[model samples]
Target: MKTIQRIKNVILLLAIITLTISCNSDDNGGTIIDPEPTTISKYVVGFQAFPVGQASPAEYILDLPSLESLTTGEISVEGQGIPLRGWRFFHSAGNTVFTAGYSDDDKCIAYQLDENGALTEKANFAFQSTLDNYAALDDDTLLAVELTYGGLSDKRFHFINAKTGLLEKIVEHPIDIDMGSGTVEDPGSIPWVTGMILRDNKLFVSYHKWLADGSYITPDVDRAYVAIFQYPEMELEKIIEDDRTSPIGVNGHSTGIEKTENGDIYSFSTSALSAGFTAASKPSGILRINNGATEFDTNYFFNVEEATNGGKLFWMDYVGNGKAIARIIVDDNIGAWGVFKEQGEFFKLVVIDLINKEIKDVSGIPIHANRYTSPMFVEDGKVYLSARTGPAIGNNGENADLGETHVYIVDTETATATKGAKVLGLALKGVFKISN
Candidate 1:
């Protein structure tokens, strides 16, 4: 009887151990066992290598503890960071980091933090054309616009599933091109998208008219145009125009239209030659479209050039509380393409109050120049921007003498800039925080 009782006890103990192991481990080979929840936070920084000897620049993504601190004198991707092929554009939504290849590749890859706190590829998808404008409708949906240039055709809008990295749907619409004076034989102007925003089931796209023949000439430079479309359906409702300012937004940089907290939409017009415009027909300014309205507000007009006494707006991002941080061009001699080619210190950081129409210059940051800068990151009323000083290009077609790149932390309320970590790359494409 004692031997039988001992055998039963041993069998019960073995069964308990087996049950514990089965609960903790994946029973099926295809099942993925999730790691324990972690409270640690990680930041992902995208860096672009200098295209000196290579045919195209390579992008690297590195996970860091903080963007403001660096253990070394300057952080580089020499033997670290996940290297990506070709020139890429980086954007983050929720916990995923997205890198869209440009010029060299037509793929967009989405990365997420794994159980080991490393950036692991989650999804890879391809697109026909480069995504020029993007907006996050929600955490799961990303709307990207592709402008079909070279001829009159239908512009494509892609609705992508952000989490699954799949193309959900594509909406094509032929946005009416305003060809002033020139006909089909000799096209005068083509619509160049500057910014896109979706608010209250309405989509607003701001664009400028430019010749598609590579001259970069603006045929209709005296009016600001925004095409309003219905959400989900993407049907064009109307094309609103404002004569108070020149074409809204600049080439390459998407800072044209910004929606405030209260739903008021403000469009910035860059009529400056420094912003890649062949001519300046109207003063660089700001126009407003009131909340719940699809037309421009006739009572609202902010003359940025007059307010700053001839300062041309280069790039801007809204912080919070009706305030935005803008990089203003201070030197008039930068020429038409000087912002891209001859970059002798010209950009000045300033805080503009959208509600009161006031401009206050930020202190502690010297004049700097940047080319093809990614969108600024705003968090907790502090705006983080990559500021680069010195020449934009060298005599040998290299990125020589292109001064050090530093992360500038700008305070929205105090209007002050505090320099942060030094980046050892051509420039920082983006800085993002992903929860781990």
Candidate 2:
């Protein structure tokens, strides 16, 4: 009796399989097969997994897909985590993404995206010490500025091979800014290197010398300064200055300036609430250099605050076709370490017309307190951004609850932003998209 029952159950299982296949076979005399995905796009975000607004365990990288079917996945370097904390800088070229630790580690890592959209460790480079400002020179090279605080002396720029993550060259530049000695009233000047541009076989590095005090004050508040160094030789050509704005770019981070489609360069200055950043010294705005010219366009000046009714320019990046997207601080009266400030509110996105010298506010971006945002990424003529509010959007938004971090997909033409994939991390260090 037991043998008969076992045989009967096996027969029933086979019959059910046969019936299911038959149902899928020729419904309405046509065959149905699932389609295959052709291309893959992703937003690679570095997750600083921590609480209390800072500090982290070993960091993780997540490759969140644009398509819904393929779930978001993490990129582990040989099954090991990448060591990143606080702010991170990234540069994307070819099918690879390059990352260097800022305000922290001395390591550089590259993740290569294959045809099937798998990010594997390509190389990991180490510096003699940690680096501050970062730039991508070309397909095979990356530039990192190792900065020291006081008066910008003995600063070094290391060029690394992107493929192998090895140091190829070094440019040692001594920045000469007259900063007072560290006393109660006069703290010396520190070279706050902001960003770099490579053109005409030379490197144009933008930075400002600021007081070493925690107030974040700029000592030389009269002119915008750019250090010109001949590439490969690393010889100082000349320091160019214009009495146009306070500083060429903001104090920290790298996206304060960029080259546009027409080979023209435009830079934005923060000129926020500080001793030298007052309106008499400089109002935050746009300044440009004509293509192949070393001097700032003397005839061109676009005062962003004057045009936008007192909105200070926080950051600007060239999106495509001579246009840029910027973040503005309207009425944020937070402190220097606003990263810990939870109640302050006022940050928005906008679009800038470089050719026409116009600034217009962008719509669809929510307002919340954001102490800082990372460098932006542009791919396929679209600007990918993280509306970085940390966790303050929760308490400040209409919902009045803790909020999560997300990236914004901006339509540059329309000046409207659409929400992208939800990022998993404390700080939205940056977003990069690798394409085939």
Candidates' TM-scores?
Answer: 0.86, 0.77
Which pairs clash in model 2? Answer: 151-189
Candidates' lDDT values, in order?
Answer: 0.78, 0.66
RMSD of 2: 12.8
Residues 1-436, candidate 2: write the lDDT tens digits. 9999999999999999998788779678647887886676666765554344333333566665563311234223334445555445566555567776665677778887666877777787777656767777777777888756544366778887766666777877666555566586876666667888888788888887766664556667777888878887888898888787778765446766688767788888877662125333577778888888988999998888778533777667778777888877755354443323322345678888878777766776676443344567666656766654433334324332355545666778988877665544444556666654
Poorest lDDT segment (10 consecutive residues) of candidate 2: 68-77
Candidate 1 stretches greater than 4 Å from native: 1-36, 54-56, 67-73, 178-185, 341-343, 397-399
Clashes of each: 0, 1
As for candidate 1, its clashing pairs are none
* lDDT for model 2: 0.66
Q: Please report the candidate that would top TM-score against the real structure.
A: 1
